[model samples]
Target: MFETLPNARRCAVLIAASLAAMGGAAPAFGQAAGQTAMPDSKAGAAKPKLWDARPASPNATINLVHLLVKQGVLTEDQAAGLIKQADDEAYIARQAAKAASTRADEAAKAANAAAAASEPKGTRHVTYVPEIVKRQLREDIKREVMAKAEQENWASPGKYPEWAQRIRFYGDIRGRYQGSFFPTGNDQFDALHFNAVNTGSPYDMASPYNLPTYNTTQNRNQIKLRARLGMEADLTSGFNAGIRIATGESNSPVSTNQTMGGGGSNFSKFGLWLDRGYLTYQAWDRNLVASVGRFDNPFWSPTDLVWHRDLGFDGFAVQGRYAVSDSFTPFGVLGAFPIFNTDFNAGTNLAQLDSKFASRDKWVFGGQVGFSSRFDSYRELRLAAAFYDFENVQGQASQPCYVQSSSDICNTDQTRPLFAQKGNTYMLLRNLQVGSWNNFGTTSLYQYYGLLQQFRPMTVSASLDLGDFHPYHIVLDGEFVWNTAFNRGLAAAGTGLPASVGITSPGVALNNRAASSDGKTVGPFNGGDKGWMARVTVGKKEIRQLGDWSVHAGYKYLESDATVDAFVDSDFGLGGTNLKGYFLGGSYGLSPNVWASLRWLSANNIGGVPYAVDVVLVDLNAKF
Candidate 1:
């Protein structure tokens, strides 16, 4: 074996011997120039030690094994043994897979044999599934799961829910721009009482200050801001309370207590005073809640401005539902406030303030009694008549001081209260909305103002809904104002009066010539206040999504005699505040939160010329 040793090794040994003969001997496997030529056995042993750095790819590992065999590091048989060992785990997995396949085949075969042996008679058994069907089922299940997740994630208690005593958010904003075309700009109109703001058009070119540019264009802009907030938390489980600041719809709540009206030092703007507030209880499942505080009477009307989501007032009221009979669960409301707005130009002008039995206090008494009906009847209708009792409190009344040759209480020191006649004042009115009353009479409404129809009292009215003959919700309404009288307190007070109802009641004949209070009355009827008007509208509705931006417009007319025997200088000016023309306007939502509105107005002036103006506005809002 020694003689037949590999020549390379023998050569290496000879080289080492020569080196020793020359000087010293070199170690085995040692190459010249300080390099180490590794032996095959050492490399093999080192490879196992290099297992951590072993080639990860199957091809690289295979190449390494082949390299060992070719270098005499391992015999082919030894290499094969190592390969077998390395593949031991893979071999076991293959065996398991093969056995499982074989079992599956046997099971299938057994099942087939059984099915053949147990063949039934006369009936066929078919079982097949399409890939499309499987895919459809998967999609359906996925959709169902996703929908379920979304629903579960999004449910939350919102603010102002009737139940849960949640937070109640209330708010509103009002704004208007006024432009007028009157013979003179010095005139003002407060419809509640006969009075004008100024004597002539403030822009009259005939006046002093010597300006050549004066064309009957009374341009003005107005801004009104109002806010409402309500919150009812569950102090316990069944009780809650809420509050709102009482103010005008066009002004801040910080109104004054003295003189109330528009502009100047008086505290009251836009004239929307407080109208509601209250505490609620639900000991009876909340179905039966009793509320007492400032609350709005449940009367349906476009003017109440409550259905649009942003309008109210301040006054004490109590309302609730009482189960009277199986066929009738009656609801009633009773409210009282010191005063009601008259919609005059400015100043907390009192529309009416009188107690129910006549006292020094101001109060309004009204109620609605309604009963429920079956689905066939749609809903239980109600019949109700309410009144805002008006009374004269000693010297407490409105009086006119000056006259534009058109006022009834102007020129002379003869004082009178325009808000009352004899000793009483108040509205005897009824709700006419279809689906809002029970047994009722039909009523028709038509409003008139200025000249002939000036201050024509509201007709005491009644209304009814005609089952289904008029399915789109047909309704009838009627109203009349009676017992007319002037405010003697005002005539004596010497306050400046508006034309038509001021010292100008008899009208000045181009000079300080004439003045009287004998103008035409609300004609056409009985001896009372006289004439009546009727009106109708289709597709009008209330209870809508309340937004920061909203708009409205309406038309009115009056029935009166053109010829009057009351006063000689009697010339009724239908211009300015006496709106006679029909108008329609609207507002649009720009962003989801920002909005804008535009309106057009029309009316006839004393000069018989039609007057009109256009208004545009933009509003932005934020909530927390």
Candidate 2:
């Protein structure tokens, strides 16, 4: 392979050299002729140390004897003698603790007996409630708990919890095939989604299914067999828990069905995945609720997948609902979460640093407030505001915000690559993993520059259901995230590029430079480099028990904020800046569990980086 090193000093060493550099850090027990030596920890009175799975080799223990001795589980003298005895037998000092413990237990027991024999004794009268009275009291308590829970469930989005259940499963499954106008990504051309009218319509025509390479009509046919499974339980009623698990395009905690990476580079990785696991408690039954865990960020969008959507964390959140009058119940929520997290994707990642929060990474905070109201006409309206604080991270270009990494640049070649990098093949290893979700990415890319430590964000949303508009809805969703720090190493501006549109990713050089140091926003004051979107869906009730069929259309203007971690490149050849487009599609009824739809998506002017794509997709889906 021919290549150019951007910085020779930064190049990675070959595996052999890397190993040799480890030297004493990794000792070989001793290799006999045509033989291999296995390294083992020392056995002694000392307890075994903590173990790390990486770089499996000899002498990887972190000495646990001192820890046990400090905890008073073993005495220092006993531990030392045990460790020394084992060291005499090939450095296995970890086994000696058992012997030392036997000696210590006998000594401690004898001492306790002496102390007890010399102590005093006292007595007190005791009385028990009658058995019949106790039984009646317990039954009464059980009835009161069940009655309290039932009261909460009577309300929508109610506050309810069961002591034995804290997690819920909710998700949609599609069973269908895809047929495309262009020759592309899949082989069958089409399958089935869960619900559809005929062969021409689809259920979720708004999804970015084919993504950058739309010409691949191979996924045209799909099925909606098992759409979703939902689980929501209150850890303790006032405190609630919820989660959704399934095998659809939506993101999961882990996918166990297939390698969610760009499914068809001829890859066969499938696995199960989870979405969100949240727990919260209300302070006064219906007044205030506090929650902690990975949960919805409060910025509403019909897009299904959301920006600033990392899914694991330790959190503290509070929400309140108050009724101003007989017809208005206003509600609001606020929360804060740390960056450290654990629920891993179904499959592993290519980079050792693919964790949501890199090691020792500092963290920022996030929160949102919202409200919804119902009117006499039976129509409901909602409004919400949110924020993210990407602390210590910023961007070099437009919106002049702070971004931890030049993420918009280093994206994998979802469309096509201009050059090859080692990271590319490393990605292949992760692609073979399973149960990954998300219609677009196998793994999300948060920081491109690798310098970011955390991200902070803000969002606002509005959705209205007009009663007289014939089962109609109007939604306006927007989010603006500022990297408290922006420091991607790249040219601040572009000098010789023509205008392009709808190119999801144009690489770092092009994507980063498009957002200029020059402040410019949408509609006003160079507006804000945030995200702006609007959509309206109007439909009638189910026709013949199939379901609602509605035609939907919307417009979106996305500035190069990079906070929304998911991005797709061009499928229609020329590629350049961020994403911008119009989605025109609708859904129709087939059977209660079957449906179909069609769509035509067009793109032109993107983040001042030139790129374009025109896509048309027809889908069918079914579920039981």
Candidate 3:
């Protein structure tokens, strides 16, 4: 029966047989193989037969034969014969498909040739990119690569580490030529070297010629240098840290200038002191800042009448500012600074016994509240009121003690100030027994002196900037301070009369304690408690570029005890209080981050004595 069928039917039967061998089944085949079938009514409503559902393809014919064999309608011998004929039909179909594919490819080639012939001769379609466009593309690619390199920190391997990106470095250097002119008739012997005496062993009053005194009538000239280097780092979580080192002759809080060849003069190297070391935290988006360790002054002052510019406070400070509007900002600062700390073993006797002294730690607790206003884009004003209270800074007199030997220590000797810069009234710190000086060969006592008046100053400062002329504006700044803790009686009795002659006076002591016709004393012993300063500056506020310039003139009147002498400006009158002076200075930019300045300061004793001095300074400064 298979030999009688056509080749197409044979090929279809072979495909069906293969499908049946691979486990294909149909409902019709199942029924034919004696499986349960659907009823006639359901079969009439059913979908088309499985063979009719397939497309009219070779597989359809194969499926018909596969069902016959699966349902036992055809034998295995017949299915084998159908498969042989199907293989032959498949070979012929493949040959026809190859010939048709070749003809289609030739047609595509002929169409492309016709299209090319229609174009003009020697004409071609080419994208001509401009050089600028090419350059832009290259730059864009380079920028992307660089950005990735920076983010991954491999732009230049080992050249700069990852952490270095968060740090900034800055520094400045200054060289100055200064001349100090001292006029004739200035008192030479009365200006005691208080700092030197207090810091070392007490001076023996029996040897009057051996006492320490300041240079009063000496005119001198010297060169000086000041250099400072600092670094700041951005730490995690809104914290910042900074450190600075500066050159100075000594660890003086008011000045960082190193006098050329001053200490032993053999071309010695200058010493570097820790100028600032601080850590700060910005809380609430920089609305409040808190700092610890030695840091810059937290308060705002118009002048250096109370605090020197180079002074660093050792303690903690908090600063807060709020912008009520675009034109007005109110700010406040509170700080606690440790001026001096008592040693752990404050007093040690000659017998190797430790009798600890009470803690005489000195501190300054200060606060300032102020507001800044901008009336216009070119005009502004600032006003501040502040109070600084010095704690445990006043000296106390010691109990009477018998000095049997040079090694005998006074009980309250530690009350003496560790450092001083004159102008304040002083009294003897130690009271010796009546016969204790027999071994010293004189009745005069060997003792140290301490400041008589305390310092708790109230200061008000103001600044007015009239920048209506833009860069060539004028600025007016002024400050007034009054010491609330000063006592007239104590200051007068401490250094005024002959009856209270044991007190040590600054400047010209004899002239201050002038004897009257009736043997009474009259002088400026009523130490003043008020100080004020005013200055006006014209032109640019800062020297930022070449040809920029600024000039300023100022007058200062600081009386004794108005403020701590050790903390005021160190350049005027060479330093200290009880002096009135006028200064003029101007600076011109030499280049970016570099400038030259000249200043003249003429100062004279406000009272007590006629000591006068004039200073001239020329400086060259650079910053990086």
User: lDDT for model 3, on a 0 to 1 scale?
Assistant: 0.78
TM-scores for all candidates? Answer: 0.37, 0.45, 0.73
**Best-fitting candidate, measured by TM-score?**
3
- In model 2, the number of clashes is 159
* Model 1 lDDT per residue over 1-624, tens place: 655744345444544565477563344553322233344575456543333334433533333444444444445776566556546745787899989977976787788768867987665655454687689789999989878655554333443323443555565433333333343433222112211112121111112123222233465444444344445455567777766553443232222111223455356343434445666666565555555665443433222111112323355555566665665555555555443333223222336452111123323334433443333463234433333333322222123222122221211111112222010111111111222121121212111111211121222333344345323344343332232332323222222334322322221111111122342221111111222223332221221324423345454332122111111011112121212344445554445434455545443322112233333333333222
- Screening candidate 3 with a backbone cut-off below 3 angstroms (N, C-alpha, C), the clashing residue pairs are 11-86, 12-62, 16-62
lDDT of 2 at 215: 29
TM-score of 2: 0.45
Expressed as tens digits, the lDDT of each residue in 93-170 for candidate 2 is 334775686687678778777777777776332444569768988999988977876755533254543433345444
lDDT of each: 0.35, 0.40, 0.78
In angstroms, the error of model 2 at 585 is 2.0
* Native-to-model Cα distance after best TM-score fit, residue 75 in candidate 2, in Å: 98
